[model samples]
Target: MSEVKNRIAVLRAEHKISQQALADAISVSRKTISTIETGRFTPSVTIALKLAIFFNVTVEEIFSLN
Candidate 1:
């Protein structure tokens, strides 16, 4: 099986936003963003879509299997 990975941190940095800021924008918790960023938790499809929309990118651009 492929391992899932994401570019959330990179995107956040590029946008000059913190985890809490992202979470607030997406209506999630800061801890949720942290866990996802650290690979300790994988976000649900809803959250993934929210992030993509917030960053003006496709979901595939943010996440992939490696």
Candidate 2:
């Protein structure tokens, strides 16, 4: 299977948001954000949608399979 990748760290940096802050906004733990950023985890559709909404971007902007 292709791996999942994300632009979360770059986007968060662009928005000047911390991991903990994004986690709080998305109702997930900071570790979840960290792992996602590091490509060590893939978020569920719900979490991905929440992150996309929080960033005011589409989920495709944050994640992809490659």
Candidate 3:
């Protein structure tokens, strides 16, 4: 852990997209998205990669170990 926090869910909401939509785009289950956003689970590298791609951001941008 010890990573900088992200504003991912807030940003997603700002974009007005549902979790299911995001999950579809990222190729993950909606539960995964919910878990990540809620800090209940940390995603694996592959899942992180998918999320980065779906968000159109670099992994560093999406996840910071600051």
Candidate 4:
């Protein structure tokens, strides 16, 4: 399977928010956000949508198949 690539860290930095803050905003755990950012976890569609909504961007803008 192709690996998933993401710009989550970049987006977080650009938005000046920590993983914990983002997780709280999205109603997820900080560890979940951290795992996703580190590429150790691939978020579900629901989580992806939540992240996109939180960032005011598209899921495609945050994640891609590499």
Which candidate number would show the highest TM-score if scored against the true structure? 4
Q: Which stretches of candidate 4 lie over 4 Å from their true place?
A: none
lDDT of 4 at 11: 100
Predictions ranked by TM-score, top down?
A: 4, 2, 1, 3
lDDT of 2 by residue, 1-66 (tens): 899999999999999999999999999999999999999988999999999999999999999889
Of 1 and 4, the candidate ahead on lDDT is 4
lDDT (0 to 1) per candidate: 0.95, 0.95, 0.79, 0.96
The most accurate candidate by lDDT is 4
TM accuracy, model 4: 0.97
Residue-wise C-alpha lDDT for candidate 1, range 1-66, written one tens digit per residue:
677899999999999999999999999999999999888898999999999999999999999988
Q: What TM-score does prediction 3 earn?
A: 0.78
Q: Identify the superior model by lDDT, candidate 2 or candidate 4.
A: 4
Give the Cα error of residue 34 in candidate 3, in Å: 0.6
- Give, for candidate 3, the lowest lDDT window spanning 10 residues: 1-10
lDDT of 3 by residue, 1-66 (tens): 485455569768777889999898878899988888877777898988887777778877777664
Q: How does residue 54 of candidate 2 score in lDDT?
A: 95
